[model samples]
Target: MKKNISLAILAIVLLVLPLLFQSRYTQHILNMILIYVMLGISVNLIFGYIGALTLGQAAFFGIGAYTAAIISTKLGLSFLPCVLCSAVMGCLAGFIIGIPTLRLKGPYFAIATIGLNNIICIIFLNWEHLTGGAVGISGIPYASILGLQFDTERKVYFLLLVSVFLIFLLYRNMISSHYGKVMIAVRDNELAASAMGIDTAKVKVIVLAISTTIAAIAGAYYAHITNYVAPDAFPVMESITFLIIIVLGGAGFKYGPIYGAVVVVILNEYLQYFEQFNMLIYGVLIMILLLFLPSGIAGIVEIAKAKYYEKKKIYYLKEVGIDEMK
Candidate 1:
């Protein structure tokens, strides 16, 4: 309960922090941060929980974006229904692709996903009639709940905040459940987990499906909020961004997504002065973080916390006059 209260306070701060910065550019950066947070959390469901190294997450993301765009524009469907359909489409894609490719492990599995993402990109680029091909889809609508439209940036921020809060809660609960423990076992040692009667393969697919669904939902919201869709928008680099998020934020942490997202997005904003050199600098930063802190910033925090507690333990013992008792 104490931990819960701490996190609750943190969440309140995060949700309200935007109020301090009313600049359009600042809000734009915040929006990007939230988007990446969604992506990171989605990837966390698979990469962190199921121990899958996926390079095809953007495939589902693009699909969801396109799905929502096409349906809402051509079919004239509403926002919520469009998002639901995209999620189902993403789940199906995960089910189909996961069946054959998820069987592979380690680098092989990663390679398969890379290939899959490329294939989807090709289709998105060439499918002119539906997707508009390289020309891209445009004029998509902003999100609307019931009759109210979220056309303004402020409204969009509110929408993102609500969705992020709900999804964060959902993933947090799942990660702390019995199933989450089984996933940790699988991640620690698949063979041992299997021996212990866990259906490792089935669990992987389920995690993939859930992760894809979440990604799709994020994509759908993005499409509506941005009011556009294009294949180039969901490139392989985007998938890498998700992986970087998981690597940079620590696995199994609910706020890991938000932390990595805010850091990277804000860094990119500041690095804009470097133009293309910004990309090189970003790459170097990732390498530096990996070398010095393999578990990322959260890992560093945990290390500091442990040391602090150790000192506390000693101080408490001394204060109790029990130092000689040992």
Candidate 2:
């Protein structure tokens, strides 16, 4: 009952957030929060569930963005089709990268992904005709549905909101299914899962593809909403941010990404005032949080809940003792 109520309240807040924050800047920040939440969820699918530390998420993210930008500008494709194509591109990239690379474990896998991102960045820089090089692509069309154009931030907020909700449903359903269990098994113990006939390699590849697809979808929306796609936008730092989101939210938990997104986005916003010290402050806070609450914000909540139940049990025992004494 409490969980349901909390969800209901969150839903209501999301629905009315745009109206409450009428400023364009605030709306833009909120939209970014939505985007980061999608990215966080995607990262969680691999990093949390499958135990893969991917640094090439921004590569797929850039691929999706560039895909949307090129198709929309050159082919004159509409929003939905562009999004689909971008997701396909991201999935293909994931497949190609994961085939030989997924076999590498631990730091080796992570290093390979970092290398992949660098290679992709170089490609984006050199492939001037396709990706517009360092100058970047611009003037992407606004997303539209049934003749309704999402041009303004307010309108874009609704579009992104629906997209995020749909993706959340898809993610929730995916994680709740048997496949999710297999992924978790792979994360916990790959050799054991393989011994159990789980096909660990295949599971990792599929989950990686799915995670890239989700990130691409967000990239697609970002291209349309921002009307631009720059290679610099999808840097390794952005990928790091995605990882941080999962870590701060307590990876492996279902709602961890969302919690992480809220905290990260709000922190970023507040730290803007610090300017030069923003990163320093950010690092300090992260260090403190990890040092004290290593399990993250979600873990704190879990600990509190456990303590509450313990107190309640003790109080009940005391009451029983009093009755017996009487």
Candidate 3:
């Protein structure tokens, strides 16, 4: 209960902190960052926890964005239903993809996903009737809940933060459950995990379905938040960004996505300010992170543990030498 309270307080702080800055554009960017935080963490559910080397996450993201846009614009569906539909679509897609391809090992899955992303992107670009093609969709209404519309940036911030909290709870519950243990075990050794009676393939499918659903939710919120959806918004590069967020945040760590989101978002804003050299900067940062922080921020924490214990060992040996009695 105390731990829950602490998390609640921390969440409140994060949600309220941005209001101190009064710029609308800044608020908007920050809200997008928060969106990515959920997306990033959700991806970690697949990539980090379940050990899937997926690269087509943005395809699901695009699916959700398009679903929400089409539903809201064409069918006049409410925001929550549209968003939920997007998640359902994502889960279906994940299940279909995972059933066959998840049986493949490592790099093959990653390579296949590259092709998948390209295929999705091209379809989105050419499917003018459904997706509005390359021209994209517009006039999406802002998100609403229980008759309360989030019309202002600050209100949206609170709304998204609540989502972030709720999803965090979902993550915590899953990660602490038997299913999460199976995921971690699979991450360590799929063969051994299967030997232990864990259905590795089924687990992978379930995890992928969950992760993709979460990503779709993020995408739905993003479409509503931006009131626009373009093919460019769901590029293969965004998938890479998601991977890096989990990697640089310390792949398997609980807080990895949040820390990674802060970095990616900050860099995006800074580089976007420069326009022409922005992608180059993103590439450079990714390289640096890959080279230096390969294990990510979570890795740093683990590394520090050894050094801390080494220092403690020396201090304790000197202070109370067992050999002195001998």
Q: Pick the candidate with the highest lDDT.
A: 2
Instruction: Please identify model 2 stretches exceeding 4 Å from their true place.
Output: 1-4, 309-326
lDDT of 3 by residue, 4-103 (tens): 9998998678867787879998888789888989888778999999898888899989888888999999998888999899999988988988899898
lDDT of every model, 2 decimals: 0.86, 0.90, 0.88
lDDT of 2 by residue, 184-241 (tens): 9999999999999988999999999999999998899999999998889988878888
lDDT of model 2, residue 148: 96
Candidate 2 residue pairs in backbone clash = none
Clash pairs of candidate 1? Answer: none
Cα RMSD to native, each candidate? Answer: 1.8, 2.5, 3.0
Lowest lDDT sum, 10 consecutive residues, model 3, at: 317-326
The candidate scoring highest on TM-score is 1
Question: Candidate 1 vs candidate 3: which has greater lDDT?
Answer: 3
Rank the models by lDDT, top first: 2, 3, 1
Q: Which stretches of candidate 1 lie over 4 Å from their true place?
A: 1-8, 324-326
In model 1, the worst 10-residue window by lDDT is 250-259
TM-score, predicted candidate 2 vs. hidden true structure: 0.93
